[model samples]
Target: MAAVRAGWRRGRIELRQSFTNRPELFSHFLWPVLMLVALFFLRHRDFGSTGLLLGTFALPGILGMNAAMGMVSMSQQLTADREDGTLLRAKATPNGMLGYLVGKVVSVAGGLLADLAILLIPALLIVDNLALGSFGGWFTLLWVLALGMVATLPIGAVLGSVFTTARSQGLLQLPVLGLIAISGVFYPITALPDWLEWIGQVFPIYWMGLGMRSALLPDSTVVVEIGDSWRHLETVGVLGVWAVAGLLVAPVVLRRMARRESGSKVAERRERALRRVA
Candidate 1:
């Protein structure tokens, strides 16, 4: 109980900073919202609110698009902590690592809530006809978002732990972009070639988008011709595998990164910056 309470408090503190101070909650989502609006105007004829075809993808696209920012932010924040010796300082303190992790998860959970609201509120207000009427679907989407968050968060931590440089961060952005493009988030997977669809199936984006659409829209609006909608065992299985894989690999990667770091190496990087500034 004590640990849970302390963790709750720490998470709230982190969430407060995430919203008001750093505003990670807002920064990562602003552009995607704009893109959604821009596309809406560009295709009003298609983005209607009736039939199995109606609103088939509004929720999925928005949610699927967000996967990139979540993973990127996770990687960058972890790297930032390591770069500034925050991770090492936590390593030295009792229960620091546990507290730090709890705070991060809480922050992510809170941020996603805010993020989904950013989509949902505007959607309900601006688009009159497309409001979600099904309570069952809403519950399912919440679970999908939760699963997606869990599945992706560990991967972010691993990337941050493995790569010490911001350059590596920049390089890895390509895969993130590519995944979203092919993941059937913005469009129907059937629209793509068979091989491309298969590639998308091999990723979390496909499942996340599938599960989200099931939750946020009517049964008639579901786009997937296949997949278990309610239970989502395959989607759940994939996410579970990724999360487990990340947990197994993260500690090893972090340890390796730690070994490569020396007092002088850190000093050298800092000194180079100082020299450049001078």
Candidate 2:
């Protein structure tokens, strides 16, 4: 209970700092603004013969993609903290690692929600044909967002434990970008080849996008989806599996990584960083 309270407080402090810090504040708005520009141009473009506007179709998917990218943020932050000896310091304290992780999740998830709002509010003005007027729409949005975060964040922590350095963390981006391409964030999954569609469906990214679409898009838009239905049960099942698996695996990986941390390793990392700067 004490650890939980401390973690919650630490997370709130960090989240507040992120909004107030100049560079972080700039970063928060930059991507959302760029996405809005893209939506502005695509807002009127027709999506093949489906009679749906490309912008409308892509908006919610973009939201899901942003939510999933919290994983990358988590990994990068963890690696950076490890390099700077934050994890080592935390390891020395009672239940400190627990607090640290809770702080990271809270800050990352809170930041993600803020970014989503920055995009969604302006997006509602720019895009048309969304089903935002109903309570069910919002309810579905809430659950999908909640489930998507749970499904991705622990996996991020595991990746962070494995990477050990910020440079190595950079290697994660290529695969993530590839996943986004196939996950139907900007295009309909049903339009892809069977093999690619199958590959996409195997991951949480596709389901997150599908869940967002189900929540936001009109029922008539279902024509573009697999089986021409929302398949809500499958979304729940796949994301649930991911959430459970990640929760089970992350602690073991993190504990192993923590055990290897020492003062000498942190100093060595700093020296390497200094040499790179020189």
Candidate 3:
């Protein structure tokens, strides 16, 4: 409990510093805000239809997109920590790995939540007459989407554990690109070929898109059919089996990656660097 509290304090300090440093760049979040405005002018009447489709369903989709962004960012930094012996130094501290991880999560979650806010402003401002009849469902949607995003945290940690360098995780580029392509993120899932549908089923984005759509839009038969039939489940059931799968697997993957790190391994990396410089 004390460790978590200390982690929280450290995490908040980092979060504050980040906000202070990036205030201007963060203000550019208005891009999404402007996008929603532009969309409103172009598709005001279609609020219940296309605009909502893009804005509402896509809100969670965009949030999920941040998961990929967050995971990659975390992985890159974590790899650097391992290479520089930062992880080893932290582990030796009384504060421990748990504090370090919790601090990281707190920091990452703040950035993600900010990104989510920017993504949402467009949907809410532009799409007037938003049926929002399912306000109750929306409450559930927020948590489900949050859970889905949280599920990706482990992916970032696992990636950090396995790859010694961000460059070493080069293989991730292929799947990450492929995930956005098939996950119906910027485009529609139905547009893809039959064989390709099978491919996207493996990742969290596909499920996040479905779950997000179910939360934002009505349970109509328009967009999804190939998967667990999110429309049929009602409310919380919208997330389906895949979201559950991510939550379950992420922690296990993280533990495995964490175990692979040892003081000797980190020290060896430092030794190589010193030899190279000398």
Candidate 4:
């Protein structure tokens, strides 16, 4: 109980700071602004004879991609904290890692939601044919978003635990970018080759994007999707499976990583960083 409360407070404080911090605020809005500009140019374009506007099809996908980026952010944050001895400090305190992790989920998830609003508000005005005006639409959106977060965040923590340095965290970007490219974030996965589509379908990002499209885009847009159906059950199943796997795997990995945290390791890391700078 105490740990949860402490983590909640820490997360709130961190969230507040992120809003006030100039650079963080700038980053929060910059990506969304650029994406919106891209959508502006694409709003008039059609996706073949399907009669679906490319931008309308992509808006939901973009939202899903942004949601998935929360994983990257969480991983990077863990690496940064580990490098700077934050994890060591937490290690010295009882239940501190629990609080730290809880705080991270709160702050990272909250920031992602805020970024969603930044994109969604202006997007709703520009993109036509979204199902935003209905109760069922909003209900679907809520569940998909919630499930997407749960499915991704723990996996992110697992990634964070595996990477030992901030530099190693950079390596994570290539695979994530590749995943985004194939996950149907910027375009349709069905347009890709069969092998590529299979690979993309194996990951949660594609399903998240598909689920979002199903919830928001009109039924006519379904033709661009595989099987000319939304595949809502598939989306839920895949994401749910990943969620279970992550929940099972993350705790073990995080505990192992946390167990290795010590003042000496942090000092060694600092010295190596200084040597590189020198």
TM-scores, one per candidate = 0.82, 0.97, 0.71, 0.95
Residue-level error in angstroms, candidate 4, position 160: 1.0
Name the candidate, 1 or 3, with the larger lDDT value: 1
lDDT tens digits, residue span 1-278, model 3: 87788778777877777777767356537555655565555543333444353444445455456555666666666777778776666666675666766677677777667766776655666554433567765765576667655656556766677777545766665667667778775545666897777676556666666665555556553445454366434323433444466446644654455567687877787787778779
For candidate 3, report its TM-score: 0.71
Candidate 4 error regions (>4 Å): none
State how far residue 77 of model 2 sits from its true place (Å): 0.3
Misplaced by over 4 Å in model 3 are 23-60, 128-134, 167-171, 221-224, 227-278
Better of 2 and 4 by lDDT: 2
Tens digit of per-residue lDDT, candidate 1, span 137-245: 5677777777788778767777777667555688777878888888877766777899998998887778788777666555654444453243378878987787778
Stretches of model 2 off by over 4 angstroms after superposition:
none
lDDT of 2: 0.90
lDDT of 4 at 155: 82
Kindly report the root-mean-square deviation of model 4 from the true structure over all alpha carbons.
Answer: 1.5
Error of 4 at 158 (Å): 0.7
Better model by TM-score: candidate 1 vs candidate 3: 1
Ranking by TM-score: 2, 4, 1, 3
Each model's lDDT comes to 0.67, 0.90, 0.62, 0.89
Candidate 4 local lDDT, 1-278, one digit each (tens) = 89889989998999999999999999999999999999999898997777888888789878988998999999999889989999888877788888888788889989999999999999999988788899888888889998999899988888998888899988998899889999886677988999999999999999989888888888777787899988989989999999989878876777679899888899999999999999
User: What's the residue-level lDDT of 145 in candidate 3?
Assistant: 60
